[model samples]
Every structure is written in C-alpha cells, then in structure tokens.
Target: MSHLSNHDLPRLKKNLAGRQEHNSLKRYIERTREREYIAAKLSTHSPIEVDTSYRVAVRKTLINPRDGLSMKRIIGESDLLPVSYMQAGMKASKSVCRIEIRDSVGRVLGHGTGFLIAPCLLLTNHHILECEEAAQFSLAQFSYEVDLNLMPLQIKSFRFVPEHLFITDAKLDFTVVALENDSAEGTTLSEFGFLPLYPESGKALLGESISIIQHPSGAPKVVAVREKKIIDVYDDFINYTSGILPGASGSPVFNDEWVTIALHHTGVPDPDDSSKYIVNEGVRISSIMKYLNRLKPTLLEEQQVLLDSIFAGSELANYDRNPMVIGNLDMEWYERSAGYDAIFLGENYAVPLPTLRPDLRRDVAKLTNGKTVLDYTHFSIVMSKSRRLAYYTAVNIDGGHLVSVPRARKWYYDSRLNRKYQCGPELYNNNDIDRGHLVRRRDPVWGSLAKKANEDTFHFTNCSPQHKNFNQMIWLDLENYILSNTETYNLKVTVFTGPVFREDDVLYRGVKIPAEFWKIAIMVKRDGNLSVTAYLQTQKNLIRDLDFAFGSYKTYQVAVSNIEILTGLDFGDLRNYDPFRTITAVTGDIEPAIVNVINIPSDIRI
Candidate 1:
C-alpha cells in the first residue's frame, strides 16, 4: 500500500485535486436549486416513469424535486432483489480486468482496474493510461483470479490497439481505449461483455449501497460490496464511503442492479491533514457518457456505431461474457448414423475412439444417453466441458462413399449438452480464427446420411479455433491428400483428431486456444494388413515476431506415440500398427517425418 503512494495514488490525487473538473464537481454538489443543476439532475430521470400523483418527476422538480425524484428507487423504496442480483454482480465482474501498466520494454510500471464499455473498448483512468502511447505499452489481463477449486485460474493478457481508437478525459479522469480483436491465443475480446455507460442518473442515490469491482493494490480481482454507501452524486462525480476502498484506480462502481454508475478515481483527501482520507470520489458514468457524446463526431462511422451500441445494447450486459451463439436445435434434423464404427475397416482391424485419462473424465460432457461420446452420422465427438471444445473426434470415413455436399457453413450448439459448456461464434467473430472441424466435414459425409452428416459437422462441439489462412489451409491440404490416398486401396479409414491442450495455451474470449492440433489415421492396406500414421499441425515454423506467419503453417507426419502423449488419451493397439513406432524401434529414434505430409506413412503405397 505504501508503494502506491510513490507510484499511483499521489499522482491520481494530484490530478483530481488540481483539475478544474474536480472543483466543479464540488461546486455542483454544493448548489441544489440552480437551473443547470436541475437540468443535469433531470437528465438522470426518464420522462416515462409514470409521473403519477405519488411521484411526478419533472413536475416535482419544477416544484423542488431534487430530493423527491432521487428517492424513487432509493433504499427504503425497494432494496430487496432476487438471488439473481448477486449472480448479476458476478456476470458484471467479467467485464472488469486488471490493467498492467507497462513500458515499451515490457517492464510493468503499475496496476489499475478497467472494464469493457464496448466489445473492443476498455475504460480505465486517464491517470493510469494517460495517452495512446501509454495504452499501447500497457496490457489488460483477465481471469486473474482463483477458480472454484481455489486454484489460480490462468491469466490471459491482451495488448491494447489504442491507435485504432483512443479517447481520454484528463479532467474527469477516464480513458476509453480499444484492444486487439483477438488475443495472441485465438480468444476474442468480445467474450468479456461490456458495461454500458448510462447517460442518465438515478442509477444510485445518496445513502444507497454500492459495490466496486477492482484489483486492489494490483492483487487479483475482488469486490467491495454492500456496506459502502453513496454519499452524494454531483454534476460529474459521485462521492462515496470507502470501506474496503478501491486502492486501484479505474474500478467500476455499480448500483444494486449491477449497472455501472461511476469510474473510481481517487480518495477525497482531508484538508487539515494529508495523512487522513475522507470519502472516495468517482467520475459519474453519465458525465463520461455526455463527454463521449460531445466527442462522438470525431470518431469514424464504425467507431461511432461501436460507441452507440453500448447504450443501445445494455440489455445484453447482464449475461455471462460472450453468450454469442445460443438457440434450440430440432434433434430431428440431425443425422443419427452409428458414430465411428471401430471395426469399419472390417473384421481384422479395430480402432476404438481414444480413451480419456481418468482425471479428464470430469471435464467430459456427457450426452443425453449418458455417454461421453456425442454420436453424429459417421463420427463421434468427445467434448471438453472446461475448454468448451472437442477433446477428440473419431470418424469412420468411407472414402468410396464420400458425398459432395454443398458447403453452406452454418454452426449450431448441441442442445443435448448445456450451452455453458460449449464455445460458440463469439469465440470466432471479428478475428482471423477459423471454426475448424475436428472431423473434416467432407470425410463424414458418406452414403444416405451425407447431407445430414455435413449439417451435423456444423455443431460447435466439433469446432476448434484455428489460425485462418495459415495453419488451417496447410492442415486441410495435408488431410485431403491422406483421404484421397486412402481411397486408392482400402476405400475405408478411421480418423481421430483433437487439440493438444497445453496449460499455457493462449486464452481468447473465455476459451483457451490449443497451440497444436493432431490427427491419427488408421486403415486396412492393400497388403491385407492394418496400418496407422500420425500427423501434427505445429506453429513453431509459422511463428514470426511472436505472431502467426501466413502461408507458413507446417504439417508434419509424426509418430503415433507423439499424438498419444500430446493429447492425454490412449489409442488401443493402434501403436502396434504404427509405422513410425516400428521405425523408431528399429532406428532407436525418429524425427517428425516430413515438413509437408506428402511423405506418406510407409503403410500406404503412394
């Protein structure tokens, strides 16, 4: 706490005490019956609240309504709310994140709190992120807190793209900066929904309880709830009691309904003694909204739309961040072929879907049939509940029976499983992320159920976030060669595909993006013996300056044992049938077989 005085607080207080906006707030708080004051107060109330005999908003203000209108929904009127009220606070907290102020050299300068006011935009203190250059160097980190198990959850960091859009008000102390649309790890910024800045007042009143979601003193996220009371709301600021005071600036102050009413800036210092502190003050949300409206013309049309959307889209603010794709799908439209026939290659061969480790069982989403495998057409998917994606997908590919279904490319949520456990379009929107299918859509489109299988492949559970135009293209090309080469002999092959989940995979839009993807192909060869091979999509070669390099995505034919180790799953007897394993045994070692997978597994007569 003492370190903050030298770093953040002293400067923050100096800005507040020295600025004209700060004194103007105090003057507004002092005067009650001025025309400007009345007009400002009226802006907080709607003309629509049924101005009955008991409560006439404008009329009473005309008849001295300051105290009357402010008390409409005040504590005594109706303080009790449903349990969902607490849940809303939890939802609202998603938008709030810890801001690590860093320099050009990546040195962390200080920490503050900030929240999204729009999908791409973040709101923090001008003192914290003073300018576009400052914003560009700083990073916004989310999920920097403990999980249900009390273990520290993975923290995801996103760089600011303030050059895209940056607006700051020094006097009132707020900065709205844009973030990169997608995180380095494929998560979209839109997943943490924004807190809309309301222009009108009456969201909270003097004496009403308020809460502040913040990163106190640069620690993990915490909420200072209830007991803290709002003392007064002025023209541009709200002064409030400071129990569990917001040590970190830029914290969002919320009303009972979880609506953001102000941006916490600094404490009101005691004049007689600098060591003593009085109530804390926050710049009002309405004031910031008004400031934005004044500067709205300066923004580009699309930026204006993003700004305008915050107000128009407040209804969606209460949902868990990025409830992007959600709807009921008629199970009847689905293709119900028995998923991934293990013996599809015939009586002599078997490739049962890979088995998950005992520890991973809890993270697997079970279907209505009480099975971990979600059977659809020629494929079966085992989805991860935590990652909201497929742990692995096994599909029986009938190379000869492959049907050409026109690609309409629409994705859906699997209603048989809970929506909360599924990643949706929200993860892919506004980014170069491709909704990659674990089971290649064409591979499972076979026989009478071909079209339905194509449609079934569109389910979100079958999708994994992939780098668009880069690894995805190369990976798809390599897969096509394997399927086409298999058609030359067996006319049948079974494939198992999945992500290689790493503890440090990039977190994008509430989901961790897998760095590498893998696939294993099994089929009967022309020699009447079974064959197995593995391939992996790695970003190591395609990485340029810490970002993906387009056209450089490399696919390598690797040992089946490599795939098994990468993914925490066991492929039964498949290893004995692996050409790479045989090669490894004879040579005492093996390397990734090929840069491009055209070096077909020796089992296939390419």
Candidate 2:
C-alpha cells in the first residue's frame, strides 16, 4: 500500500528525483547497456567486492552478459540452465513466510512477506518491520499455503528475538532480524533452509529476469517468477519493471537459480499520473552483506558465530583470506598502496608518527632492508625488538570511502621480520590471550585496497599480546563509539596506537602482557582546524595486583602530554592540539583515578 495518498504521489516523485543518490541511480541504469561502462565497473569491484565465482556463474546464464550481445540473442541461452530448476525453486520457497503485523491487543494491523537469511534470522522491508518494538509485536507464519488436497497446512509461527539481533537501515529500506529457533507448532527453524546472502554483485545484471516470492495482501505465498525483469543494477539498489503487485512489499527478489538478489521495498509511481506505476525498487542483498560485515565486530560472540555460519563454505572463509596463498599463488604482496599519509586529513594539517625517546630508539626493529618503519596498505608499524611488540602504529582512515572487509580467523607473521621477534601464534597457544591489533583491521580498510589492508592487519607486527576480556569488553565499547563519532564528523582521520609498557609486566608464556593501551586520533574539523584527542584503557594486571571497575578496564579521555610522559614518546606539535589538555592529569594519589572516564559516546571529546 502507498504511504502517501494519490494527491501527494506526484510531489513525492518530484522530491525523489532531486536526490543525489536517486540521480546517480538513474544515470547508472541508463548506461548499463554500454559495454565500456560495464567493463569499467567490473574492473573496479571485481575479485573482492565482486567475487570471481559469481562472475563465472552469471556468464553461463542467459542474463545480461558482458560480451555486448543483444538481449534478444541472449534469451536463447536460457536452455543452459539446469533441468532441476523447478526442484531448486521448490527448495527455496520453504524459507518464505507471511509477516503478520499486529497492534498491542494482538489485532491484525497489516501483512508483509519475509524470508529466512539464516537458520533463525528473517529479512524483510523496513516499512513492514520498522523497529525493534514493531518486530517484537509481529509474528512470522510459515507453511500458510494450502496442501495438495486444497486444504490449508498446519501453520507454524515464530516470534522475533530482537534482543539477540535487530539491525535495520532506513536508507536501504531493509530490516534483518532474529526469530525464535522453534515455532509454536513444534517445528525447528532448521526444517526450513535459508537463502544465504552473499556480498558480491555478479549474482545478477541489468536486463536479467528476476522473481519475487510474495504473500500479497495477507494471502498465501505466491511466486512471481521471471515476470518482472531487472532493469537496472547500481549501488545498493536494483530497479525493475512495474509488473509486481502493490501488496508485494517485503518480498524476496531472486534470480533464475533461486538465489536472492534484492529485498522488495516499494514501487515507483509515474509522476504525471499517480494511478499508474513505472518501475519497482528493491535493496540489493550484496549491499546488506557489506553492512553486516561492518557491524560484525560490535556483535556478541554468539551473534558473530551465527553470522559466520552464513558464509561458512563460501570464498570468504579462512582459507580464502590469504588470497595469494590459495586463490592466486603466483601473486605476491602489492606494496603500491601508499601507507599512512601524514596529511590525509588536511594538506597543511600534517600529523606525523611519534618520535621515540633516546633509550627506546635502540630497541626499534629494522627490516631486512634496514627501514625502521614497516609499511602495509594504509598503515605503518614500528616494532620493539626486545618487547616483540609495536612501539606504536600509525594509520590513515578515509571514513567516507571505507568498505567492510570480510573477517579472517588466522593472524599471520610478517615475512620481513624474524619468527623469534614476530610474536606469532606461540604466545596465544592454550590461553585466553588475544592478538590485539595496534592498527585496527577496519581502520585502514577503505577504497580499493580494503581487502589488502584487512589481510595486512593480521600480521604479527601490527598486534600486541593482550587479554581476551580486555580486547572485547569495556575497552571495545569506548573505541567503537569514538571511531564511529569521528567517521560521522570528519570522514577522514589519522590514528596512533600502542600499548603502555612497564618494566615489571606479567610474563605469561614467555611474553609480557601490557595491562594498558593508548590511542590518539587526529582529524580535520569542519571549520578547517586540526582536532586531536587521546585515550587510555587500563586493565587488571595480575603481577601489579591492580584492579578497577570490578576488574573490567576503564577507558579515559586523557591529555596528550600525559600519554607522552607515560609512553616516553614525542608527539611533536600534535600534543598541543589536545582538546582535553588542561582538564585532566596523571596524579600521585593512592589508587589514582582518571577524571575523564569515557564510558559512552556522549562522554568522548573531539
């Protein structure tokens, strides 16, 4: 159903046409038939953003091939599809369901369609399941269709578990939610196989035939297969012709292989006459997968495990992470990516790496080529030879161009450094210690080199041996908020990070576990001035017999000078730019406390 009345339909179209994203979408759709444009797009996102396997699959299909063949000629290629196409469709339909939206008293409000993207997770339109509260009050009813005898099958219904996982994006107009594992009718969610959502764009192309499994107007499930063709495929959205029924919102749009392509949202109305629809719009599944990767780090351990299951056997698995070793053995590390640009924020606002104190410089590890600084993708590391950890790491982040790199399980050792000083997997064996990243995996992941940077972060030179609890507890909350805030504000930032070492640190498994870590962020403010801020996270040190915040570490917004004094390093002129400079201090009181503890987003200072 339309959100706006008939009278306002023309005005809605006019306003939408003015949006930058909408304009870009139209331009991309218009140029889809151009061979040069298609080739350019493929080269830009292929292998990483657009997987190689998906490309080969799309090539074998009758869809819009990149060979410049006319749509008329390609239609004859449909015979290439498998003979079990009908059986594939039958298996896919089991995941579809009718989402019954209701009021506080359990009165039926309306209905929409949804599908299982995971064993116990459902995907639908945001307009249907708007918020966490809305999802909690709704029900997902499966097997509502009739049997072969023309009698209704016993319906199995499940309630939403929003507390476990509820992620929505208003711009994309999609919602991904968790459902109870078991339904009221004693049916396990595993009985219905899910449509795994992949993050590559080669699943479909412009002019490809698409299908939608919908429960129109609260009725039984129906399949509108290959009726409405995909007219356009662009950033995060797919545009199709207007053959779809009005009440089919929240349906899952699929390709010939029954693989999901989009989440059906709304129809585009003809501006001149509101009664007639022109094109239909849906949020791309690939875009949603990318969004999930960004939010994965913030999820609980259980939630992450569930999410990882979706991509278990696919190309994103652990073996595929070291792409060169498995997929392209001939390929070596590409060192062309400019690492840690000092003036990335502002041309004149240069923030270089911290200079080491005289005594600390003697312990700096040099590579085989005699360079003290090791460059990898967007970040650089300066390792401590004696401590076998980074003295400090620097990274340049382009928040605007940032892309989510699929997570990897293995942390590798840099070939440039010897195994003895690399602090590889030996320290973490049979222990709760984590290979804490100094240059965060996601920090340097942006632009075309996002995948490379992600792999580079796994190198041992970029991490420190830290406790598992400290790596994922209160400290994680504080860092996520601060970094997200900076990305929201400036869109570009340079960060410096490392652990605060002590002479008498706890020696666990032949390595000293630094109980505290520090980070400093620099960004160009909207007013064109440089803004720098420093943070400190303290954790329980067994050897020191220190504990705070019920043994959980506390993150604080400390002055840069204090960090300099503690780490025995020089931040150059960057120290004077601290916003919280004079408000806090390193005191001598018994059980000394940091005055500016940053527990939440609002507490962080720019």
Identify the leading candidate in terms of TM-score: 2
Q: Distance (Å) between predicted and true CA of 111, model 1? A: 0.8
Error of 2 at 444 (Å): 1.1
Residue 31, model 1, lDDT: 50
Q: Kindly list the per-residue Cα lDDT of model 1 for residues 168-204, writing each as its tens digit.
A: 8888889988887677777666567667665555556
How many Å off is the CA of 6 in candidate 1?
Answer: 15
Per-residue error (Å), model 2, residue 237? 18
Total colliding residue pairs, candidate 1:
3
Model 1: lowest-lDDT 10 consecutive positions: 58-67
Can you write out model 2's per-residue Cα lDDT over 497-542, one digit (the tens) per residue? 8988887687766777787788888876667667788888876542
- Model 2, position 216: C-alpha lDDT score: 89
Task: Report the C-alpha displacement of residue 165, candidate 2, in angstroms.
Answer: 18
Candidate 2 vs. true structure, TM-score: 0.52
